[model samples]
Target chain A: MNAMLDAAWAVFVRELRLALRRPAEATQPLVFYCVLALLFPLGLAAQDVGLRAFAPAIVWVSALLAALLGIERLFRADVDDGTLEQWLLADVPFPMLVGAKLAAQWLLIAAPLIVAAPLIALALNLQPQAIGVLLLGLLFGTPVLVFSGGFAAALTVGAPRAGLLIPILVLPMMCPALIFGAGAVRAAQVGLSVEGPLYFLAAMMVLSLTLLPWAAAGALRNALE
Target chain B: MSGLSKRQKRMAAVLVLVLGVGGAAFLGFTAFSKNMMYFYTPSDLLAGAAKEGATLQLGGLVEKGSLRREDGLKIVFVMADCEKQMPVRYEGILPDLFREGQGVVATGKLGIDPVTGERTFVASQILAKHDENYMPPQVAASLKTADGKHSCAPFKSLGRPAENLAGKPMTAAAEAPRS
Candidate 1:
């Protein structure tokens, strides 16, 4: 357990450092989120009805995109710089290493989306109660996003067109999270209980936790080969 | 003709092998059409849908009122090109922007009904709304001007502003999940 915690912690630090090193690029998703937010009001003619109607989806989608944007770096950069090779050669077990990296990515990417959610929710004029649910749903959904992203990054670590291919392959798989995340929040906006959506997101997180990390490690090893 | 030295013969043979292999592979890929996604216009797909396990890409606009959930998980929608429609079944959640009248690209396999063997496809991936502005990294080469300035790649195609757009970096390109 100690060794596992240590490896997970190490992955977390390395992932954080990587993001902080290029704060501009690291913040690019937030930037994308901001830009996309601005687009809806401009494109949709800025009516409150349209904005409120689409708010949950817009927020979750942007957040999902933000999380996805940084994921390719998860394995690509490590592979390119030989850190992944070293990690594979290291004393730590591969699954722990993979889980650790995913945990780190969720912290850096999803955590920000959660923090930024309220402000975006306000901008979109989402209901106050809905904003709370949106934030919570994202909290659960983002982890799954990170887990799935790790899987994609590991799978296409070295291909020339991996950058493009990864998104095509991974986005479809992530639709579940996007759906539940948005739906829960949307449900709350109408005074409905968001329990189902939140539970669904939580279920996705658990399912991903059980299956995705091993898949990611297997892919990473394949990438290393 | 003069007889070639051993080294010259070896180099010539290597050159021949390269040309031969390259030619054969190129022919094989193209003849097989293995690399490009199999594209079916909405009408073509509806007319002769194939059996299951055959993957295809169908591009069209989402049909109005057809974007609803049957079990909150299974999404049934229709893709149209104004003149034709292909029924689409997606078993998971959909992209946020999936809506009526938006252009979409769906990827999945064909399924034939047991009773009639009539074919329909199951799309797992759906790209909603065709956008006007796209500047891929590779497009950078083509986007270059005589002055080395980047060409204006606008998002207007996707229903956005034409001006003040950065090559926009898609900055969102990396947002797809890794697995």
Candidate 2:
């Protein structure tokens, strides 16, 4: 167990190091998130009331797309460097390594978006309670987004135009997270109980966390072969 | 011979794929179906399709000359999809963009008049669209006619009249009858 954890830690650090080295890649999704969020008010010519009404949906969609932006490369670098083959041969559990990679992706890519969500929510005129719910929703939802996206990324690691394929494959699976995430904020805005949607989002995260890494490891093995 | 035949391995792989995909789809669909409460048009209400007293969304344009104000912040208006109309009662400060002939979505329960048996939407929250150029996509989709055209064509094609209504005092008691 200790060895498995150490291997996973090493993989996590290596992935983070690669991500930090390419500063543009790390920051591109955050920039995309901000730009798309700001564009809603401009495109709608909406009043403050209107902006507030749609803020939850807009923020959720932007987060979904932004998380998607970096997903295609999740397994590509490791596969290209033949590290995937080495991991397959290693004594440490393969799924733990994949989980570490996904954890790193979520930390580096989705965490910033969750942190910056309040600023964008404020710009969209969301209520304080609603903004809080948005933050919680993102905290729970982004991991599911990363896991589902990572699965798609792994599945298409050997395929051509993986960047395009990842979104097409992952977006449909992302519907539950988007709905629950946005729904929680909307519920809070309208003085309804947000617990229902928040619980649902939490369930989705748990489900994805339990299932995705193993599926991704299986896909990576297929790609390596 | 191998520990497990290639055919057995292939069958096991297919079984896992089916179960995983099927289970995910089942869970997703069940959740979606449970939460898929959609906006009902006035016609749908009139058709008796909407459940009585269940909280749901009603989307349409506020009818001209149907808005009224009662004592203690109570406001009443008629929401129309051009073909059918339903009365809505709300007791709150409406969004600034709310006006006659403009699109709005009201979230509430369906109630029937005790005497007249008229279906009324008792709104808990009212959401008006942002501007003249924008309409909620759900409202737009619901308002589409049989010919794939908007049933609320006058509001869209006759842009001047819609703009004129925007300037009207949406919450003013003036010209608003007591109910």
Candidate 3:
């Protein structure tokens, strides 16, 4: 148990260090997200109506894009430095390593998006009632993103043009997450029920948690070999 | 040519051959498939010979004032190609990105005599093509473009590994807090 914990912690610390080392790169998604949100008001004709109408999608799209922006680095640096091979060759199990990196990724990338979502919501003209749902939706959605991203990262680990491939493969899988997360906010924005989409989001999180790490590690092993 | 090692030359030659064959095959298939992914403008969709149960993708600006919510959960939005409008019914919450004016693409089987398209979409994948540069490189490059539509290779195709942008400057410091 202690060994497993150590491996996970090591990966988290390593990723965090890299993120801190290059603050500009690390913060790109958040900036992109906020800037894009600003476009809503300028582009639309009516602020009040457009704000209510566009709020759900703005939050989800920003979150999804932000998630994608952080993905390439998940394995790129490790592969270049030969560290990925070292981890695979090490005594620690690959799944644990996968788990740790995923956790770190969520903390570094997804966590920030969630924090920034309220600002996005405010920009989009979302009601206060819907803000909590947006946050919760992100809470559920980012894990699925991290899990799915791990698989894509593993698949394209050494593939040429992987930066482009990750988004392509990932956006398709993001359908369910986008639907449910945005659904929750839309439901609350106009005083509707939230149970169904929230449940769906929860289900996706549970499934991704249980299955994605192993699949991701398997992809990593394939790329490594 | 001057920098090439014999072993590296062999690898490069093999790569060129693979790329040539793969690119040819993809182009051939796309032509054969009638260039499957044509984004139907709202008016185009209505004018088309949309037979019952024919699978199709409708793309256009989401119509304003046409949004109707059922219990504030199920959403129906209009896709207008400025000439015609097709109704897209989505269950569950939408993304913060889904607004009336934005361009959207919805994929599903055409409803049976207009069966609300519910049962069909419920069992199928309804996705929006948010951007033109979306498909994975291999898939895009491999896809048959017979109809000559969807031929825009907007993304810098498969030149670098995904990580090239990881350390690229974000052009904004506000993206990540220093802490």
Candidate 4:
């Protein structure tokens, strides 16, 4: 009821507060995303035409990789400090609490990546209209990344040195999102209708947001046991 | 609404979310079903799937002897699906992999031949279809008849020209024959 929502709100607030406490952690993936995108213009000798041609792919790949950067730490700190056990014992539904934490991660991690993407895409010479489609693609695509990555993070929360394991486990599952996300931008850049890829991405985000929180909660229980 | 139990409210929210997403996906799928074809075959164009003057991708095998390279970069070729064939005219430096009897996809508009009043696909850009192992022309021709499997043949080792020349419009100087 109201109590569950209040508890979920409290957990979300706490997660955001913790992220603010370590501001570098929140900004690190964004910096990684920007740097990866910025490197393409320097490395490629071609002028604006070549850079613009590759802009959508570069921006999408960098965003996908950057999303992975913060996912490993998604549940690690709570597991380390025994806060996960407290969450399990709380009266609110455990999945709701996990969803709230993931929402916070999406805000702190994926949101920044999306916000910073247009700037990076512009640097790569992507057109303004294409940049709008790029933004929309990331808006729908990144939540799926966060939720799916959070599930992988949850699965590996108890594993020692699980840094590289999360991306390896989740990247294959996240391929469709990457394809549709990048395809939308490419279609827009080439003056094709972007609705198809954007719809697929939106469907994926809805399905992920609906289902992954419970899946992650189940994985957390397995790790706890 | 305020008196509803929390469980009922949760169900309502979940129902709304699912229905909303499902409706949007359904609408988009229906609206874009025509545009989403990877590339339209000659049969598709002949059947009137695309309107005249609208840009689209035309894909098929280049007929074995139908290639005519005019002066400069202008080339005319017959692109064939299993059921029908269409003539495509393009003015560009053909990709390195461009060859007769290989699969190709051209992006451009469908126009009418002014003299003959016949349909012509005027391509702005031409790309060689890239596949790992191409079937020979005979096998591809037979396969196209039997099961309608269009395989790119004879052009090996070339990456997709689409990727190489994406968003790079070539110079189209009205080189297509008027007749």
Listed in order, the DockQ scores are 0.01, 0.04, 0.02, 0.12
lDDT string, candidate 4, B91-151, tens digits = 9878887887667889998998654577899999889886564567875555443222334
Per-residue CA lDDT of model 3 for B17-113, tens digit only, reads 4654555455434322331224334443444434434455555555556767766676666655433456676676455656655555576544532
TM-score of each: 0.55, 0.61, 0.56, 0.70
Q: Estimate the lDDT of model 2.
A: 0.77
Error of 2 at A52 (Å): 1.2
Per-candidate local distance difference test? 0.67, 0.77, 0.65, 0.77
Give the lDDT of residue B14 in candidate 4.
Answer: 81
lDDT of 1 by residue, B9-90 (tens): 4665466446545554554333233211234556545554333464556776676567768776887777664345667788
Highest DockQ scorer = 4
Q: Distance (Å) between predicted and true CA of B108, model 4?
A: 9.6
Model 2 agreement with the true structure over B9-91: per-residue lDDT tens digits = 46654665566556655555444433333466776577665457556788877877789888888888898764578898899
Superior candidate under DockQ, 1 versus 2: 2
Report how far residue B8 has shifted in candidate 3, in Å: 46
Residue by residue across A1-225, what tens digits does model 2's lDDT show? 465668889999998898899898789999999999999999877575678878999999999999888677777778888898898987666777899999999999899999999999989888887888999989989999999999999999899787777778998879989988998788678664566577667767767876898899999898888
TM-score of chain B of 4: 0.62
All candidates in order of DockQ, best leading: 4, 2, 3, 1
lDDT of 1 by residue, A37-144 (tens): 667767776565778888888887887777778566667667777887887886565666788778877777778778888988888888897777887888878888
Q: What is the TM-score ranking, best to worst?
A: 4, 2, 3, 1
The CA root-mean-square deviation of candidate 1, after full C-alpha superposition on the true structure, stands at: 21.8
Worst 10 residues of 4 chain B by lDDT: B169-178
Chain B, TM-score, each prediction? 0.47, 0.54, 0.44, 0.62
lDDT for position B30 in model 1: 39
